[model samples]
Target: MDKNTTDTPTEYYDVLIIGAGISGIAAAHHLQEQCPDKSFAILEAKESFGGTWLTHKYPGVRSDSDLHTFGYRFKPWTGAPIATGDEILAYMKSVIDDDGLQPHIRYQHTVESASWSSEENLWTITARRSDTGQSLRFKTHFLWMCQGYYQHAEGYTPQWQSMSSFKGQIIHPQTWPEDLETAGKKIVVIGSGATAATLIPALAGKCAHVTMLQRSPTWFTTGRNANAMAEELRLLDIDESWVHEITRRKVLRDQALFVQRTKEEPEKVKSDLLAVLREHLGNDFDIDTHFTPRYRPWQQRVAFIPEGDLFKAVREGLASVVTDEIDSFTTHGIQLKSGKHLDADIIVTATGFNLSVLGDISFTIDGEPLNFGDTITYRGMMFTGLPNMVWVFGYFRASWTLRSDMVGDFVCKLLKHMDANNARKVTTELRPEDEGMTLGPWIHPEDFNPGYLARGMHLLPKQGNKREWQHTHDYWLDKDDFPAIDLNDPIFSYAR
Candidate 1:
């Protein structure tokens, strides 16, 4: 309860964490073990605890991947696999409560800037309270940034030309207006990712008609969101560790098998996946237009629904899919490039998120501006020139939490190594030969918008391994090698 410790330069905390989301929470949980006396404060932009989980509450917002590997490894989920937003939020809140982490959290404090001071060996953080707009400054020796991309919790909704002229009310699923009534209205959902897929089905049941508008195709799959195997294990008299291992391996195997099979032969995999989707949709579903995806299976995040509920909604005549280029917005509805018009009373734009690096917050080391564009990503956790800073960004190819957990473990180990050595700061430095490496498109460079893409391939690490760069996006490899990674190696040195 050290609120408003802003009269003078606040007491120097050994560690400072930005964003109280899962990643930040995990960081604090482990950081305490390494340096128990080191004070740490988690500065959150919002008023509440759950970062993305509480922020995004769109109609069918849930995890596309399984929950077993999507959360902290230290804490296992006792419920279903693909958890809903509410469930995930509750889990996050429980972690805060169970660990007594509320005292470390300072809510409504939005970080505006953080600059490293070489002379003082500390970081000066400036933040303003969201409610009062009062600015405060805090200092920390080590900083961990965990805030995610996306400016607002209420997802992104683009301005369609002449959208205002439309006769109906428009709704972006991200900021779903609680007061706006949607009962018996004709709804048109834009985009084909998880949000669109989830929303189409959830809205179809209540709406008079629903139309899913997609510019390009995306890989879609059907599975039971809930983990049946876990439930069965719970009913039986089995060891808890055995249950965890069984569920973990099962989920991992299922996801790995699907990815491997799809990668072995993309065309056949695409055809078969589409075929399954078509069958789920029945004769009424449009296979030629809706079921086909333009990209390969893993190019983008696939859409998953519990037991083909979206397809069921389509077959039940509650919703339909339209795969066409959007021309523009009409007075009463949308005009498609196919010269077709669809009337809608409510329009939900689920186009996707605007991905930003380091929560799009700019950083500086000493007096020089740290150009993220020129910096090379080291281990997907730290940048080359960034000293005393560690980042937690997940791999798009695998489970997000897998990399997060690994990074978390590695960071804790790194912290312990630093504490034992009495080192104040540690940074990743790349040799000149390691420059000019190209990173894969999994991180999506073009996704940057509204002044967020400060770094490109120059910033991201290379796809393949070359000693200093460990781009092992694989979970199993990380579990095996991450803890054993040489923290005391001369290449990565520490300064007192």
Candidate 2:
């Protein structure tokens, strides 16, 4: 039966934004200011806000990238370069409160599905309200999906054979137990990414013996994750634009230089970096087994834990590294392929997460379901033939917020153009000539699988030079092209 219509208020939001993370909040904040008269609401899935910052609770979780470059240019980092989870969360809250965005947000409203109504020229979004446990729908002209991958805080862990019979308690870093009693307990962390690298040292301080299990090695570098020039800019009493330019330029230059040094003179840079690790581990440690990565530099994300601190944790007897493949689990502990048994009370799966395409939500256009695999990405911003919508996804090669910032401004400009011309709907579709275009594997080839790896590798847009088809991966080029993009181009035509 049709639910009670009298009790439910029927309101129209001009724009509907999904997720309350950094990207979503930034979009909302900008949209709220530009279109105050137009109704808008940010529909969040969780009870409270702070998307990734709110979810990731693992110990030693912090940004490896410099905060000045990592954070929003509109909001400068008041503290150190690299910030902890708490500090980042505080910064988000500060932005929300200062902008007075409380009234515009409806928390605990998890969006289940969204479809475009070509007949009505509006997007009907369905969501489940957490508090009342009631189903609600909102009709809006535009939908902004900023809900990132992993669908909140759920980490991925595969089931190993004979693992259930093991006496040890299994834990995932994503949902780390707050009341975990790791003290004096033998712990084994499985996986070799940044999470496992970060957790080993943090848990080592308290646990009796911490062993880091790795299937493959990663290039590790630890440095100050902050912009040095940013601090100097603030002190010099220079203009904000000047501060932004100097900071952004220095960061880009440094990152480029780092890539250059590694690629041009591999032996020198490699020896120097490995020497640092070797020195930290002392002469007795095996460099080949413990430090070297299988792939070239930057092929995978380089793990950073503050200058061989994780290695130091291992060297000082706080933690130990075990490079092996898991064979099976015994009643007391995990058994490696080499017939070595590691007795442990707890096992942490620092495995990884699923690469969700548009946050695992299905899109439909005019009663027809949209298949992402069949469609090619348009200019790395919008998808082909998906009318009246633009999805903003950040670049993997550079900082996320940097690319997202440009996307946000471009959208605002598009909205302004739509308003001026009295347009009802706007959509960007790739030119027919650009169909069937492919891109390089977003995930490392060795790590490729049909499940999680397929989405990122197969669906990511190809890098190009044309503003419409190009993904320059250069910030200056994006700023020049996107900011000056002509919204009234014949390809993106307005409808009555």
Q: Model 2: number of clashes?
A: 1
Query: TM-scores of the models, in the given order?
Result: 0.91, 0.90
Best candidate according to lDDT: 1
**Candidate 1 segments exceeding 4 Å error:** 1-8, 239-241, 432-467
lDDT of 1 at 214: 85
- C-alpha lDDT score of every prediction, in listed order: 0.74, 0.74
In candidate 1, what are the lDDT values of residues 97-162, reduced to their tens digit?
888899999999888788998788789988888787677888988888888655664555666677
Which 10-residue window in model 2 sums to the lowest lDDT?
442-451
RMSD of 2: 3.1
- What candidate 2 gets wrong by more than 4 Å, as runs, is 1-7, 225-245, 260-269, 432-467, 470-476
Residue 421 displacement in candidate 1 (angstroms): 2.0
